[model samples]
Target: MQETYRRSADSAKGRQRRAELLESVTRDLAEHGLVDFSLRRAARAAGTTHKVLLYYFADGDDLLAQALLRLRGQRVGNALQAVAALPSGTLGDRIRAIWPMLEADATGLRVIDQAIGLAMYDPARYAHLAREAAEQYLAPLTGLLPPEWSSARREEVANLLLATFRGFLMDWRTTSDTTRIESALEALARAMDREAADGP
Candidate 1:
C-alpha cells in the first residue's frame, strides 16, 4: 500500500538538494506532526523558499508523501535497533520487549494518529498515508522473524500485528480506555507467544 512521491531530480546537484530538503521536511514532520503542517514552515526550516519546495515536489501533498516515507523508515529503523538490543528469546518475547519502545515514540505515534483520523474522517486526503504507513512500519518487524519463516508467513504476522496495534491505538484515541486496551494487548501477546511456540 506504499505510495510513491517525487523522484530524484535529473541533475546530481538537484538530487542532492532534494534529498537534503526531504531530510529537513522529515524532521519537521516528526517534531510538529501533521497538525497544521505547512509548506512554508517546512521551507523555512529547510532554509529554502516554498517555491523551491514546489520545484522539487509537485505540490505539498507530494512533499508530504515523501516525508511520511522517510519518517516511516526512521521509525522502523529505530525499532529494529531497539529490538536487536533486547535479550534474545522467543519471537513473541522480543516483540514484547520492543512494544514499549514503539509506544514510547510519541512523535511517531502522533504522526500515525493524524493519519488514523484522516483515514476515518477524511479518507480522500489521508487513506493512502495510513495504508502505506501500515505496510512500511511493519516491514522491519517482519524481517526480524526467524529464518525459517517464509516471506508469506512474515507478511501475514506483520500485517496482523500492525492492524491489531493500530486498532488498539484507535480504541485509545476514541475512548481513552487504556485499561481495556491494555487487557486486549495482553491477550494478543499471549496468543502471539503461543503461535510462535507452535511455529510455521
Candidate 2:
C-alpha cells in the first residue's frame, strides 16, 4: 500500500513538472521562433536542470513537437474568440478584426511556417501535427460558414482563406509593408464573402 501511494504521488509531481516545462518552452517559441531553440536553454528558462528536461522530453525534436502542439492550441483559441466577437457585418469586417491579431504575433506565425517546411522533409513528424493544426485552427473558421454548404465545399473555402493568410504573412515577412498586406487581406475577404454566398 505504501509503495502504491508513493508511486501515485510521484506521478502527480511528474505531471505538474511536465506542464510547467511545456509552458516555458511555449513562451520561448512564441518569442524567439524555433530555429535557435535549445533544450538546455529551455531547461534554464523553466528553472530546471537539463536532466529534468530530458526526462520529460526525450530530445530537442520531441520538445519542439510538443511546443508546436501547444502553440497551435493557443492560436486556435485566439481565432475562435476573434470569430465569436466579430460583429454582424460583411466578411471583410470579420477578416480585418482577425488580421491584426495574426499580424501581431509574427514570431508564432513564422514558427508555424517553419514547421511546415520541416514537415515536408519529415513526413511522420509533420503528418500528426498538420492534422491537429488543420482540425483545430482551420475547422473553427469552417464552422463560421453556413451549415447548408457541403463538407467538400466548406473545406475548399477554408483552405483558401488559410492559404491567403499564410501568403500574406510570407509577403509581409519579406517586404514589411503593412499597407500591401492589409490590401491583400481586404481583397481576399471580399472574395471569400462572394464565394460563401455563391455556394461552393
List the candidates' TM-scores in order.
Answer: 0.82, 0.80
Identify the candidate with maximal lDDT.
1
Best model number under TM-score: 1
lDDT agreement of model 2 with the native: 0.74
Across 1-200, the per-residue lDDT of candidate 1 in tens digits comes to 11222434546877889999999988888888888888898899899999889878888888988988886676666677887887677676666665555555566546756666867888887788878887787767687677687788888887888888778767776797878877787788788778777766
Which regions of candidate 2 are displaced past 4 Å?
A: 1-10, 106-110, 117-132
lDDT by residue (123-175, candidate 2, tens digit) is 87666655655666677778766788898887887887777877776787778
Worst ten in a row by lDDT for model 1: 1-10
Residue pairs with backbone atoms closer than 3 Å in model 1 (clashes) = none
Residue 129 deviation, candidate 2, in Å?
5.3
| Model 1 whole-model lDDT (C-alpha atoms) | 0.76
In order, candidate lDDTs are 0.76, 0.74
